[model samples]
Target: MPRVEVAEQPGVGLDGSARPSEDVVVVRPDAVIVLDGATSLRTDLPSGGWYASRLAAAIAERLEEPHPADPADVLAAAIRAVSAENGFVAGHSPSSTVALLRWTETAVDALVLGDSPVIAFGPGGPTVLADDRLAAVPRRGGGGYRTRLRSGAGYGPDHVAALRESGAAMDRLRNREGGFWVAEADPAAAYRARRARWPRAEVHAVLMATDGVSCGVDDYQIFPDWQAVLDLARRHGPRAVLDRVRAAERSDPDGSRWPRPKPHDDQVLVLVEDMALA
Candidate 1:
């Protein structure tokens, strides 16, 4: 059987921000799934956290049964189940990202939606299993080609420094116009954006994390070692990692200092190893 491990961190903002960590993860013999709720949009059904939690739980439960390897049906059912239970569709329209990596006896299959990435690693280093938005703020000057930014914390040094010096850039980073973020809501696009090559490789470990974690690293640094992050999580635990990230973002001298009552974006990671190979 496959082994699983998980960690979740809450962002640093708001009265009940600590209560609404939107990161979710699943570890099973056959697969691992990670879900990250969006940060911009709000929901009436208790808040964005409800949607993210319900969707993750529903999907995890569905995976317990035999189903198609495609994450689309899994997500579609999860959305319906959660929405029905919540009783109001629009009340919980927070968009979120999804990363699901399924391992079969002979091969591996995966899917991703909205930027939360899935990475598979081995001796050759790592390869991305799936790619999603992973960004909260929209790219500059609109259109798909522009570099997407994040709200509050997670801005690049130049942007952060500028925002710290002047309030104007902060406003731009938080702007909802030209396609800002909305948490836990169904992604405007499907999570099944790509497929992965799990069978051909001698997999060591797999990782999935939200933008909050990715922000700490460089864009070119995709698929940083899962073992390293997992080691940090193991030694310090998830809460500590979150606290450290919050502190770093809060104290970052770069002008993009996160304002008080910071948004509590949930952070989570899923780690797994191939049991058969072991």
Candidate 2:
């Protein structure tokens, strides 16, 4: 068994209103799963947060059916089931990134679909499992919105228009070949997740996080590296890491410094440590 510590907070929208976080975390006896739903800008479709809750439930249900089910297989089945439940069409449905880490008596397994990542700390050093396809895909001036925000534009009517414009543009590339894969209505996307395995004895701890929390390291440089993140989580608990992310956001409230989509995004972190390591 592993000792799990977690901390999560809902995102604050541009208006400074708290919204239910689209991030989900599932801690099974043998696995830790994290999902970060993309924010839904379209009114016709269901919200990403709502879709993520249903997907998380589906995933949890499938994990209990048999022992050590392949994470990719489980995710595919869940996506199929969830898609059927909502009768959603590909390229038009809400989506979420996935990060999964499962452990058995002999091995540790990790899978990452989309931007959410899973980091495993073992005797061999830290191993990161992440899918960067969404980021790697080319876009039409993808940084334009952020740059606008940083240039004293602020989050106002123009920001909303820019969001709509970017969202429509990205819709064409989503789920398409050579573009990016995410957990939407397409079950095949789950199979495209990144995967890795390691000897159970070698792994001492695992860290799973949604992009909101990870942006602190990946974008804002809040802690330097993943090793530093692990050190903080192990020493001060997962809450400490979240606090650091929040503080960073607070310092740049108007998006003048970081120029993010929103002032504060939904944040969630999970640290699973081997009991033997304790």
Candidate 3:
């Protein structure tokens, strides 16, 4: 069995209430699943966190089956069940990113369905499995939000409006041929996940990061590389990395450097280490 360590905290809602992060993590003796739910922009639809919670439970139930299935199959069955339960439509439904890691005595399987990334570490540095299609989507006003944020527009109504606009634009291309894909109401998206496998002996550790925690390594450049991230998490624990991310965001209060949707996002990180003696 792999040893797992995790750290997570929910981001505050617009009302400043303690809202749970849309991100969820499920770990078993041989597997770890991470989900980052999209925040809902519409009141009529269920919140992303709400959807992710039920989806995670469904995934957990499927994983408990006596006969194990492939990682993609697991996600597909869970998505199908949840979408049916909620009467979700393909393009108009709450969604979440998925990162799955499953290991057996002989091999380790990894899959990334969205921005959430799965990194495997062994002798050859670290191998990162990520879906970067979302980043390719254009922002409204030609990336005006980041500019406005850098120019000192805090999380006011204007920023909120920009988010809504960008979200709608992104939604148009979601799960489409050229846009990007996530675990939404479409079970087929699960098959579209990026997948990789490695011999168990080749993997010493694995780390899963939601977009919130990953933005640090991605945009903030806090860690030099994936190795640095793994080192920090292994040494100080995942919460320490979250603290670093939060501190950096605090440093750039107005988001002059890292212009994001919010000052802080839902932070979730999981580190699974091989228990075999070196």
Candidate 4:
């Protein structure tokens, strides 16, 4: 059996109040699943963490079933189950980013929705699979669009209205024509997720992470590259990498260095190592 290592940590909100992490990591005999629940801008709906936990549990259960099914189908079924149970409205409820990697002796299968990334390490090096369309949404010319939302900036009615407008604009693009996809109330988005397969022989290790950890590399430019993240996991552990990320965030408490929605978002990581090569 392949050896797997995992780590997770909840992050504080901008006010330094601790909350349950919305990120979830699940490990099976042949797969690793990572999820990042989207923070809801509105207060009337259930928290993103609530939706993520239910979805993650449902997905994990589907994966553990004996019957064989396509990864996309499995995810779709999970979404339907979660939505039915929670009565969540499509395009109006909390959602999550999905990253999954399932492998057999012959090949490795992958699926990615939203920004959570999957990195596969092979003899050729590391290949990173991520969906960046969410970030591609045009931002206002001034910086700190997300930072202002949660930086305790004393938002007035105009500020709140502007943020709501931005969110509505982004919503129109979700899981639609020329728009990015995610595992929300709609299951169709699962079929639209980025999918790939690689020969098992070509893959030596697989790392799945939510945006919290990946932002340290891709967004914050903390590490030199993806390989450095893998090296950090190999030397210390997944939690060590998260620790470094937290340390970096502490250095930039006021978003002057890195303007993000939250000062410290939840972090989750899973590393699957092929024992045959180890």
Q: Which candidate wins on lDDT?
A: 3
List the global CA lDDT of all models: 0.55, 0.85, 0.86, 0.82
TM-score of every candidate: 0.66, 0.95, 0.95, 0.90
Residue-wise C-alpha lDDT for candidate 1, range 1-278, written one tens digit per residue: 56666667666433333465766776766777777765432223355455566777787888888655366677767766666675644323555667778776666667776567776776777677545332444333531111222233333444333333332332333213443322233332344355575663477667677766654443323325555565565576645544555555555432233332133345676666553374
Instruction: Give me candidate 2's TM-score against the actual structure.
Output: 0.95
> In candidate 3, how many Å is residue 223 off?
1.0
Models sorted by lDDT, best on top: 3, 2, 4, 1
Q: In candidate 3, residue 146 scores what lDDT?
A: 80
lDDT of 4 at 147: 56
Off by over 4 Å in 4: 142-165, 275-278
**TM-score for candidate 1:** 0.66
lDDT, candidate 2, 1-278, per-residue tens: 78999899888755667777889888888778888888888889988888888998899898888663688889999999999999998988999988888777888888898898888888777788878898788756645677787787878768877877877877888888888878999999988889999888888888899888888888899889899999998889988999899899888877888977788889899988873342
Model 3 lDDT-worst window of ten: 11-20
What's the CA error at residue 103 for candidate 1, in Å?
Answer: 1.4
Q: For candidate 4, write residues 156-252 as lDDT tens digits.
A: 4444455666667777888876778888899988988888888888888888899899998888899988899989999999899999999998888
Would you list the rank order by TM-score, best first? 3, 2, 4, 1
Prediction-by-prediction clash tally: 19, 0, 0, 0
Put down candidate 3 lDDT per residue, 52-137, tens digits, no spaces: 88888888788888877988899999999999988999998999998888777788889899999998888877899999988877
